[model samples]
Target: MSVEAWTTVLVILSFIVYIYIGWRSRVSDTKGFFVAEQGVPAVANGAATAADWMSAASFISMAGLISFLGYDGSIYLIGWTGGYVLLALLLAPYLRKFGKYTVPDFVGDRYYSNVARSVAVVAAIFVSMTYVAGQMRGVGIVFSRFLQVDVSTGVVIGMVIVAFFAILGGMKGITWTQVAQYCVLIVAYLIPAFAISMLLTGIFVPQLGFTFGDIVEKLNAVQVDLGFAEYSQPFANKSMLDVLFITIALMVGTAGLPHVIVRFYTVPNVRAARYSAGWALLFIAILYTTAPAIASFARYNLIDSLHNKTVAEVQQLDWATKWENTGLLQFEDKNGDGRFQLTPEEASNEIIVDRDIIVLANPEVAQLAPWVVALVAAGGLAAALSTASGLLLVISSSIAHDVYYRMVNPHASEAKRLMVGRVMVGFAIAIAGYFGINPPGFVAQVVAFAFGLAAASFFPVIILGIFDKRTNKEGAIAGMITGLAFTIFYIVGVKFAGMPTWFFNVSAEGIGTVGMILNFVVTLVVSRLTPPPPADIQALVEELRDPTHHVPIALTDIGEEQLD
Candidate 1:
């Protein structure tokens, strides 16, 4: 079969499987829609969490980022993976034990104030919107390239598919579907990586392939010959300070992401939550380890393929022309030479080629079979769609459940609330699709800002709410406002005013790092200055710590009064 044929088959199969799962697990009540009725097994929850966590950023763009940035990319690898440790040790178990449907619910009840809950709702919406826009863009990119459709058409297709599954399955459908998606996406990601790694380093394992001394020697020679920094080493241009700060920011931000933390709530108990984190990390490692190999292999092949090829020759290549048509790859015959030169002189001034193309274009560059390429295309779509649906659900729930039901109408009917949530989903998708079509900047950069916001505003408050008995509503609210204000101000300042040229002299990468520190400090200071939480709030904390006291209740069995 042709690559396109194989791609069609895979995508069709994936869609059918997802729809079947959704149909099988369709929810009739709010509990099933929101928390899967807290029945998800640890293993299944782990897989779902992995799929939810590995957004378009991980599946489509991380390798590309690494291909260009070299050692600096390790920050993402370590930072993201290491976050599971924090989740496992500090956050997940307690949150699970708390037995809440949303992060805001925990905040609202623990702080004894609807205002604290409202603050969480705002942060969740902002983070989810920022993240979802990137996922939609990923869907558009995959569709445009592999499906031979325009990006706008692809976005529409994606929206329809997600709406169908999410509206039907809710959390129950999404969890099982995401487990399947994790399998598809991880397989799609690792197959090409393994092929490339074996071709270049004669190793099947990408982690070992990267460290193979013989391959490193060859890459070092290639780098020196091309007048580029040695491939085996870090970039000379990147400052040590920048690397440190970026790593810290990513670590904190990973811990802060509400969508990821919310997964813990689906598992049955504290022990399951801990085990689920382990499972999530194992799944994530499958991609993270292979990603750097894809980066190394693709970078090597890209430079080798284009090094001395004529413009005419490159234009004749199928992949080159295809990508050029998408405006993702561009070339210029600088120095008036007919042959393309990929040295620093050419890389510095040519039209900007998007980093996201590295994974999409890798198989073609290696001259691999078309089926491999098609599988990658399917994987990219799966990654984007799965994440988009999850984010949309969170956004809709925040508005409908947190804002409408909790604040606006405490006596709202279940049917009315469900209708409101679905409407909110539709509205959020439309707005997010617009942003994806005309992205303001790099997808990853925008995602980082979202992470920064989460790290600054939500993570600290949630942590304090669970662990500290003395953290009152006043402290939590003040801390959230102060942290959010400072972080946003700093982000805008640096983005517009150019860093002060002296503040901490940390690398610009440390923007999130600084924001996260400010959040933690403000929370601690405010909590210390305020009165202790009410006696009932302290009791809630005690209840959260004792997993044995709470029994799992099926959604169909739980009453509306229990939820309230």
Candidate 2:
């Protein structure tokens, strides 16, 4: 079959599978829509969480970013996956024990203040929207390439598919569908990676083999021949401080992401939460390990093919013109030469190659059949759509459960609240789709902003709420405000105003790290200065530490007390 034929079949089959899962698991009440009625098994929840966490950024762009950035890309792999370690040890179990539907609920009750809950709602919405926009853009790119549609059409189609499943089954539908997506996306990601890995290094494990031996040798040889620094080493011109800052920023940002933190809410118990984190990491590792290999192989192929080749020659090839039309792959003849230079300087030119295309382009580079390329296209869509669905759920739940039910209509009927939720999902999808069509910046760069925001705002409050008994509402609010303010100021200043000469002067690469530090520091200081939390707040903390304190009930059976 032709590549387009395979892509159409895969997309159709995947959508059918999702609609079937949604139909099978459709729920009639708010509980089923929000928390899967807390019935998700650890294994199932783990897979769902992996799908939710590994958005288009992980599936499509990470390898491309790594391909260009080389060893520095390790920051993303280690930072993102290592976050599960922190989640498993520090956050997930306690949040599960607290037994809440959303992060704001825990903050509201833990601090005994509506104001605290309202702050969390704002933070969640900001983080989720920013993250969702990236997924939408990823969807558009995949559609434009394999489906041969415009990006705007692809985004709208993606939005419709996400809304269909998210509205129909809510959390219940999303959970099972994501599990299926996890399977499709992982297979899609790893198959080509495995093929390329075997061809390049003769090693089965991409992660270990890419770093340890044969691949490094090849990279060094390529660098020497191209008159570039050895790819096996870090960039020689970059400062040590810049490297340190970027690494720390990425790590803290990973630990701070709200969508990732919220995944724990679906599990039934503390132990289950711990086990689920393990499962999520294992699933994520399948792709994470494969990503570097894809990067190495693609870089090798791109250089080998384009080395010393004229732009006219490359443009004459079908792949070059096709990619150029999509605005993904581009060639510029510098030095008034007709030839396309594959040098670092050429690759670094301001006219960017879309990072998301790296994975999709890998199979073609390897001379794989068109069917494999088509499978990769489907896989990219699956990754984007799955993550978009999860974020939409978060957006809807925040509006319905947090703002509408809690603030707007305290006594609203469950049915009325659910209706509002569904309406809000449509609105959110429309807004995100708009952004996807007219994306303001790079998809990966926008995602990094979201991560930085989450790290700054939510991470501190959740940590203090879970670990410290004395943290009062005053402290939580103050810390959150301080963290968010500093992060935004620093990011905006660096991005727009240019880095100030007198600032701590660490590379802006890790500004998120600095913001997280400020958040932690401010929280600790404010908590120490403020009076201890009320006695009931302390009691709530005790209750959250014990999973056996309450019985597990079907989501529909949950009362206000359980949800509150």
Candidate 3:
């Protein structure tokens, strides 16, 4: 079969499998809808969480970013991988022990205030919406190339598939489908990586391929000859301070992502959540370790196949022509030289390729078989849809459970809540689809914005709420509003409004670190000015910290104390 034919077959099979799983795992009650009744096994939950966390950014864009930025792209690798450690050690177990349906549930009960909960709900929506937009754009990119459709049509198709499963099965459906997606995405990812690695470096292991075969030296030499910085050199684009800030923002942002935090709630207990976190890190490492190798290989091939080639020769290449149709890759004979140029200067450069397409186009550029190309399309879809489904759940659960049930009408029935949750999913999908069709930036850049938003809005309050016994409702409310608002204003001004990067020259991508600092400082200062939390909330915080099974409050003469 041709590449498109094979891609059509594989993509259809994957979608059918996803829909069948969603039907089989359909839920009736709100508990089943929200947290899968807390019945997921540790290993299974780990796979689901891995799929959830490794969105389009990790699978399609991370390596692509590396291909384009070369060594400067390690920030994504370092910050994203290091974040799992924070999630496992600092957040997952404690939040799991709280035994809530969502992150806002914990914030609401811990701070003893609906206002705090409302702020968290809004933050969740903003972060999830921002994050899901990237995933939807990824889906559109895949369909645009593989299915030969307009990106807008592809976005609509993705919205339909995701809404069906997410609305039907909720958390229960999304979890199992994600497990299947993990298997599909990992296998699809590793196969091409192994093939390309062996072809380029004569090594089976991609990590060894990039390290032992002198591929980096060759790429560096090629890049330098083309008026670009050596591919292996660091600080080619972003400064050292900007790198540090972006790295911290992504790290804290990963740990605070509301969708990922909710994964621990699907497990049985704190122990299970811990096990799930450990397993997820292991699964995620398999891909993270292989990305740099693929990036190096892809960059070398792209330059080798196109640099100084005639316009007619490049136009005859099917892969290059198709990507151009999506407006992602283009070629022009600048200066009427009848040949393409790969120089760094924008005026003379005749080839324009979006970094987001590097990974998807790698196999085609290398002239791999049609099946390999098709499998990559399937994998890309799985990665995007898995994360999109999870984020949609977060948005729906925030509105239906956190705002509607908990605050608006505690007396709402289980069926009504479930209906409302499904309705919210439809609404969220509509919004996500719109963003998909009209994305603010490429996949990785847009996802970075989401992480920065999460870092600013949720990380400080969540950590403080867990560890600080005296963190009152006023402090939590103030911290969340200040953090989210400050981060959003900076992002909009710098990215959309052309505002100067006047704050220590930190780019909008790294401004979340500053917002996080402000959140912590404002929270502490406000907490000190206000009265402390009630005794019950304080006792709960102490109990959560206690290692024993039970810790009761004891009266110690003048002041109340915790009995460990």
lDDT of 1: 0.78
Q: What is the C-alpha lDDT of each candidate?
A: 0.78, 0.78, 0.90
- lDDT tens digits, residue span 133-186, model 2: 999999999888877788889999999899888888988899999999999899
Candidate that scores best on lDDT: 3
Off by over 4 Å in 1: 235-237, 345-348, 492-509, 546-564
Model 1, span 1-564: residue lDDT tens: 877788888899999999999899998777778888878999999899999989888888888887777777777787777766776678877777767777777777777777888988888887788788888888888888877888787788888888888888888889999999999999899888888888888888877898772665676688788777876577454677777777666677778787888788777777788888889888888888788878888888888877778877887888888887777787777667677666655544343468888898899899889999999998888888888888888888888888898779979998888888878888888988887787645556666677777777777887887778778777777777776776666666776677563556654345766766676677678878887765656776776666566653222222333232
Candidate 3 per-residue C-alpha lDDT over 455-555 given as tens digits, one digit per residue, 9 for 90 to 100: 99889888988799988888888988998899999999998999999888888889999989989999989999999988877887888877673322222
Candidate 3 lDDT trough over 10 residues, lowest sum: 555-564
Against the true structure, candidate 2 reaches a TM-score of: 0.92
Alpha-carbon error at 310 in model 2, in Å? 2.7
C-alpha displacement of 520 in model 1, angstroms?
Answer: 2.0
Q: What 10-residue stretch in candidate 1 is worst by lDDT?
A: 553-562
Better of 1 and 3 by TM-score: 3
lDDT score at residue 326, model 2, on the 0-100 scale: 80
